[model samples]
Target: MLARLTIFVLILMLLAIGWKAWAYRKSALSALRKVEVISERFTRTDFFEEDNRRWIDSGERPDVVFMGASITSRWNPEGKLGDLAVAQRGVGGQWPSHYLLRFRSDVVDLHPRAVVFKACAITFRPGVNDKGTRRAILDLTAEAEEAGIKPVLATCVPVREDGNTVYGSDGKKLPDGINDRMLPFNDWLRTLAAERGYPVIDFYRAMADDRGFLPADLAVDDIHPNDRGYEVMTATAKPILETLLGAGRG
Candidate 1:
C-alpha cells in the first residue's frame, strides 16, 4: 500500500510540474517559432567559417571534431575529452543540410583525426523529412571519408516530451508522433554504423527512458538536456571517441 501510494504521489507531483510548466508555454513557443523563422531565412555558413580557416592555416590540428545542431553547439567536451584537442562545429538549429553545406569549411579543413556527427532533433520540422536528414548525414560522412577524416556518428539526445512546451504531455498524446520519426533515424544510423564497421555513440539510449521519452529529470525543457544529461552524453561519447581516434592513428 505504501509503495502504491508513493507511486501515486509521484505521478501527481509530475502532473503538477507539468501544469506549472504550462504557464511558460507561450514564451517558449515564441522562442522556438522565432528559431524556425530564422532557420528559414538564414544560413549560418558565415558564422564561424573564417575562424576555422584561420585555425587550419595556423597548423593547429585538433584531435577530434564534433558537428551537429544545437546540442553539438552547446556541448563543451574539452574537459571531458581531456588532453585531446577538440573542435566544436555546431550551429544552433541546424539540420543535416546546413551541416553538409558548411562541411568543408568547418570540418574537413580542420584536418581532424575524427569527426563525431551528432544528429539534430529537427525530424519533426516541416519540409524536413527523415530521408533528407539521412541523406545529409551520409553525404557529410562521405565527404569526411574522402578528406581522410574518421567518421564517427552519434544519435541525438532524447526530448523531454512533457517538459517541452512545443510538445508537452498536457493531457495529450504529445510528442509520440514527432518522436516516432526520430526512432527510424536512430535505427538507420545504428544499422548503417554496424554495416560499415563505423563507431556510433548512442546518446539517445543514455538519456532516454524505457518508454523512449527524455526523462523529465535529465532535460531542461523539451529538446535540450540539462547538465546531468550532457554529463551522461559526454561519458557515453568519450570511450567511442577514444577508440575511433586510436584506430585512426594506427
Candidate 2:
C-alpha cells in the first residue's frame, strides 16, 4: 500500500510539471518568432570570418578541418585529440544547404587531408529544397575523394522541437513538432551517405533521450548547443575522424 501510494504521488507530480511546461511553450514560441525575424539581419557570412581570422592568416592548415555552424565553431578537440591537427571553421546559424553553396571556396580550397562535416539538423525541407542541399554535400565529398581528401560526415544533433517557429504564422507560433521536416532530411543524408560510401558520425544517438528529443540541458536554446553538447559531439566524432585522417597519413 505504501509503495503504490508513493508511485501515485510521483505520477501526479510529473503530470503537474508537464502541464506547466506545456503552458509556457506558447510564450516561449512567441518570443522565438520575434527573434527569428530579427535574426534575418545577420546574413550568412563566411564560416571563418570573425574570431578565426588568425586561422586564415597563420597560413598553417591542419591535417583535418571541422566545418559547420556555431556547433563546430565551439568544438575544441583539445586534450582528447590534440595530437591530431584539426582546424575549426564554424559559422553561426549556417545550414548545410548554405554551406554546400560555398563548398569550393571555403572548404575545397583549404585542401586539408580530411574534412569533418558536422551536418546540423534539418534546416531544409526534404523533397523540396533539400535535394539541392543533399547534392551539394555529395558533390563536395566527391570532390574531396577525387582530391584524395577524406570526408567524415556527422549526423545532426537532436534539437528541441517545440519552439521552432519556422513553420508557423506571424504572431502566433505554429505547432511545429520534431517530425515536421528535419527528420526526413536526416534520413536522406544517412541513406545517401551509405550509397556514396562516406564514413558517418552518428551524434544524434549520443545526445538524444529515449523520447527522441535533445535533453533540455544539452542545448542552450533550440538548435544551438552549449559547451557540454559540443563535448558530447567531440567525443563521438574523435575516433572515427581520427581513423580517417590516420589512413590518409599512411
Candidate 3:
C-alpha cells in the first residue's frame, strides 16, 4: 500500500510537469504569431483599394495626392490647402517599397496634377533596408514624372526626445543613432529634389527645435505630429505647393 501510494504521487508530479511544458509552448507560439502579423504588414498593398475605387467612381480628380506612411496618414490636407482639391492616400506602418507597390493605383490612377511623397521616419530605424528605401523613392519619382504628375518630396519629420530615449510607432525605444541618420537622409532628399528639379517641403526645418529635435509642443510622439505640428507642416508646405502647381500651368 505504501509503494502504490508513492507511485501515484510520482504520476501526478509527471502530469503536472507535462501540462506546464505544453502551456509554455502554447504561449510562445502565440507570441510568434503576433510577430508574423507585423512582418507581413509591408505586403498589405491592398490597404487603400476600396478608397481608391471610391475616388475613381466619383469621377473627380484631385489636384494633389499626399502619399506616405503614418505621418501622412494623419495629415488632413483637404480644404486646408487653399482651393485645391486634395486626396490623402497615406497608409500607416508602410515602407517606401510598399509605397511603390500602390503608387500607380493610388497616385497615378487618381490622375492628380501633383503628388507629395513623404517617407515614414520608421524607415530610418536601425536594421531596416535604407538602400531599398532610396530606390523605391527614386522609382516613385520617375513613375510620377512619366505619368505627368509633378512629384514633391518632403523631408521626414524629426523625432522627439522622450526622457532618456526616443520611442517609435511600435512602442519600442529607438537608438539615438536614428537621429544621426535622419539628418543625412533629409539632406539627401533635398539634393534629389534639386537634381530632379521639383519642389521639396522642408518639414524638418519647419518643426525642429534649435537642437534639431522636434519640440514637445509640435510632437504627438517620437515621430508623429500633433495638430500644432501639422499646422506648422501645412504652413511650410503651402508656399512650396502653390509655387509648384502654379509653375505647371505657367
Query: What value does the lDDT take at residue 244 in candidate 3?
Result: 69
Sort every candidate by lDDT, greatest first: 3, 1, 2
Whole-model lDDT values for every prediction: 0.79, 0.68, 0.83
lDDT of 1 by residue, 1-250 (tens): 9999999999999999998898679779999999977764565866776778778778888888888888888888886765678888888877887788778877887888888888767655545767778888889889989999989989877677653323443544444455677777889889989987889999988888998889878877788888888899889988888776652332
Top of the candidates by lDDT: 3
Candidate 1 similarity to native, TM-score? 0.76
* TM per prediction: 0.76, 0.68, 0.77
**The best candidate in terms of TM-score:** 3
Clashing pairs in 2: none
**Model 2: per-residue lDDT, tens digit, 51-127?**
34554577755677776877776677755664676667666666665566555556666667778777665453222
Task: Tell how far residue 133 is off in model 1, in angstroms.
Answer: 1.1
In order, how many clashes per candidate?
A: 0, 0, 0
* Model 1: lDDT of residue 80: 73
Cand. 2 Cα-lDDT: 0.68
